[model samples]
Target: MGHLWVIPAGPPLGSALVEKSEVVIRNFFLPFLFIRIGLLTDIFSIKDWKAFVSLGMILVAAYLGKVWGSLLSLIWFKTSTRNDLLFGCFLNIKGIIELLVFLRWIIYKPIDVQTFSTLVLFNLVLTAIVTPLISIFYKPRKRLDRISKIDNCIRTLQSTLPNSELRILCCIHHEDNVNGIINLLRASNPTEMNPICAYAVHLIDLVGRALPVIVPYNTQKRRLVANSTDRIMRAMTRYSKGSGAAVKVQPFKMISPYNTMHQSICKLVEDNLIPLVLLPFHENGEFQSRTACVQNFNKNVLSYAPCTVGIFVDRGLTYYHPSNICYNVAVFFLGGPDDREAMALVSRISSHPGMSITIFRIDLLENSVESENDRCLDDAVTKEFMVGNVGNTRVECHEMVANDSKQLMDAIKKEKDFELVIVDFAEGHMMSLLVIQSVESIKQGAKLLPP
Candidate 1:
């Protein structure tokens, strides 16, 4: 009745009461009851599986029957295969209520001591096993469908406006992340013709919470939504207002489980038809690495995001100052879809008057030529940039051959004056083996790499 009647009615007090009651029962009642049961049971009796085979068979039959029946009933709802399995696993649990019923049966002597012990053990083992299984197998089916639709919408938008407005989804962890993202956006150089539409999400980790909420953030009554008093939202609003009419920023606050927040971020990006997602590097500015959870979130987001993604490692972004700074950006083109995407991004940034870009196309002699088809795609993107972005004069391209790690290191060491170095993150799903080899070599020779 606590979970069923109280929660659905939408009263905060009722939910709080229920949660408190659950805590009391779990902490005060259950442990004492379990201790009593343990004191009564004989370990020697549990070892007599042959004698308790009749009771064991009944437990197996009951457990399997419930699981199969639950799965069959769920099929009518058109749920994904994962949900069906998770539902079945959940139904298999014989939890606190069942434990209480067995205790009453034992007290009334409706069951023998041996039978009671066997059933108690069965209940304990089944619940423990099913709890972990439910967590492991539960994949929210709606999230996947949402991602698919987002991909379709983004593809349509890109085809329609190839050289125009670049829609970007930016993720902000806290107030500290706000300046870094804003500076990077400023460096991207938004203009009146080819503008930037940014959607910023203030990611909040939901701890001891039952619901996930997405709230739009602003200086109005909207702040009441999702208990949001976000400093990041305020900062982003200021940045958008000061940046002129060319750049548009939409601020949102998202609350989700830290472990699975990447799914929510990806869904939002897809829904908004965002072409690029700008994420902060997992390492903080103070030379401290963030938590493992954050690092994994970045990795998972890259795998699930439908659009191009860039991890911004903010090195002060001093080049963005308009008065006297000339931003020099160097992109290492290792050859792949991600590499092409990085080059396209650099070209977009190069449109700004104060920014100059250099494209370093690294050629591995051993694995130089693949297929005509792949080569055509890479060549087409490069040719398109040259032909279309002709008004921007400060751009250069270079071809270099590096057969081994030593040569790759030597090649990278040549660029000493670049303010920003952009490299395609390799080891993605579609990355070729040759590209992986070169990426590894670059990673191994990181001291020669630029800041």
Candidate 2:
């Protein structure tokens, strides 16, 4: 029993005895003692009216005093009301000390049997109520590392200048996320003037590991922490090499539980001062259904991410053919922050020689032309690419109304084929951009591409 208390400061020795055995201690040691106290307690002893009233009044005063003090401290410190109540409840908890003191009072006959029983019952009731209330109200505070200060003043991402760097944080887990992301990076067409810095984050769910690990592949540390993550790093490295000129890639492997992984990603984004975060869409496709944990992780990241987030819905552009090849891409703009960002990315892709792009701007039948307030810089740039020779003959622009998918597909069916479609993450109007192709149609679309 004495040896059980000896704990080191790290790893298997300290973690197993202290961290891992907490559940056992909570369930067995504490509950057994509490049950024993309950069995020893006499319920009928509280029937004495004078003793009951006196003990109840004392208990109420003590509880209110703790609550008042906690409320004052929380207010003075400007803490949240939920935490204020939780702190009060935590302070009100009567653990073994209270029980022991009361037991001593009983042994010394400071109170009669009825009074003692009432006081004990008061202690137990207050403790029970406080424990549950605190549990309900308590939430852990969000903490960020030291890296959140860089570019913290910037509000939104802007278009890169000729000499500017476009920094992106890309998150991936499954191999299914590989193709579309690589294609999207290719579309960016990093050049000598305006370079691209992509941080490829391979998020792995921590299992039986004692500590979270962050492994950087840019260093010469060749010890593979995880095999699957190693494969992802290698693939990203190859992609980076094949993408010539100003494309730089740094692979990072993070091992954390899914519940807290979003926080890690946010810290990474803040540290890197990344302007954009690309995440895989959380819907089930033909290959795999999204796991509940991963879906929840995605939701949390979307909610708490420090940078602009784009959820890519990969509709099998690379699934059919080699990702190294150039793709026929289309951009659908429905007018929102996300759509603007998508268009800005596509504008960069238009500069690539091997890429062919078509911009589809959706318009309402009631208003064929966009209002002044609705027009943005992204719209202006797309229009410039349409008429000007910046992209020369590679880019084309078209306008569409409510029912235009049928017409657009038919038009593409006539002369050319579109391998990938990039659209904003929006509902109703933008969803029309994600057109499903049958197996036969996919084969036909592939044939239309130049060999």
Candidate 3:
């Protein structure tokens, strides 16, 4: 078999879970022995020394059985000590599996007093505590290519969907521009999916009452929470038609009291397993600072969101719908994993079966570079992804004679009409300013007339 096929799918829950898995592996005897001790702790059980000795012997046998089996295989197979030890440790993590065996024995009425009682309490509490953590380290086999593209998938979605509607999650403060946003969602001809959902997870303090955050136990109390979320959704749906691409409002619980709005938005996306259009108000100034988004906050909800997070600007260069005209969309690539991912995403969106794209890239031209090779020019777009040019479509790797950010913007504005200049691999802060300037130009209706 190929080395790739042998590779496990990701270790989910990341380093924290992995570290815990290692702990579970290292301290392999404690939890199990404690469970055995718990069975002996029962007052109705054996009152003699022989009974305790027998129980201890069985525990010792099981321990040696696992450790010896691992050591023998490791020494015989002969790889690295570290690898062998890790494999041995990983193999002996039998919290859930052992309990399952014990349960089955009890069901058949064949289990003895000691084994039955030990396994019962073991499965119920201690094993339950640690097994899930151990399971995190082992993953089902999958392609490395697939793993590299999408980070941790919370759940693999069964129903494949073609997204059409611009899904928006509106956080209404005082509800001023709320109507405008709803109207925009209503106007768009979205397919199959709902357009917008105005959700309000309000922060409130209940006087002289404290609700415990206990799942399954708090099921009855959670029904009241459903009403608020349902009401907002109904209201948004009411304004537009109750069905089809309609704007809907929803509210969720402020599950974590201290979670920042950004992180909450991210977590909400992850928890629900959906792409969320975040409608945060974008002003004429700079966007929210990185620190402000998720700093000093104990938990980050926004950082770990699975799906695409779209932040819609309230005003300024609105290119949400750009009149369906061929505009120069110049993409910059700096050559890395991030750049590669960006290229892949763009190619998926623009490339098709027969048609070509008017893709542009930046290149530096230098004279007297080389004799035969003369490889001074840099073509950022990889050849495999770029198809041949057709009609008005041409892949122009613009030789950088002399053009900074503003100059590049001016050149594109002066030379050709563009829907929106999408830069793929830019330094984050610099990109923000370029985007703002481009938006301003769009707002002013300044035209280059004709190139």
Could you say which candidate leads in TM-score? 1
Ranking by lDDT: 1, 2, 3
* Model 2 CA deviation exceeding 4 Å by range: 1-159, 206-219, 224-226, 241-245, 256-260, 284-290, 319-324, 366-371, 376-379, 387-391, 403-417, 427-451
Q: Could you tell me which residue pairs clash in candidate 1?
A: none
* Candidate 2 C-alpha lDDT tens digits along 1-451: 2555555443335544565777887788888866765665777766768767876898799889987888887657998776777778878775787877776776688876677678777887787777877666565424432223334424234444435778878888767677677767766677767788889988776654657776686534586464566667777788777767677888898877778888888878767777778776655555244366676776666656655666666666544223345667777666655566666566667677777777777764443455565566656756665655453777777776654545544544554557766654333221112222222243233222112
Q: Judged by lDDT against the true structure, how good is candidate 3?
A: 0.39
Residue 33 CA displacement from its true place in model 2, Å: 11
Model 1 misplaced regions, further than 4 Å: 1-37, 40-77, 80-82, 91-119, 128-160, 222-229, 285-290, 319-325, 429-451
lDDT of each: 0.66, 0.64, 0.39
TM-score, cand. 2 vs. native: 0.61
Which digits, one per residue and each the tens of the lDDT, describe model 3 over residues 1-451? 4564232222222323444566776589657755654544453553455765676577657645765677676567876554444455555456556765665675577855555665454345434544564466433212222321345532221111324333334443223334444433433333244243444343211111223121111212435334433444345546545544444445443322233344455545445555433333333234234223222221122224343322333442333322232323444443333344334434433432221233444432322232332122223335545542333244554434323555544545554544333332222211111111233444332211111
- Taking every candidate in turn, the Cα RMSD to the unseen true structure, in Å, is 7.3, 8.6, 16.2
2 or 3, which is superior by TM-score?
Answer: 2
* Cα lDDT for residue 87, candidate 1: 70
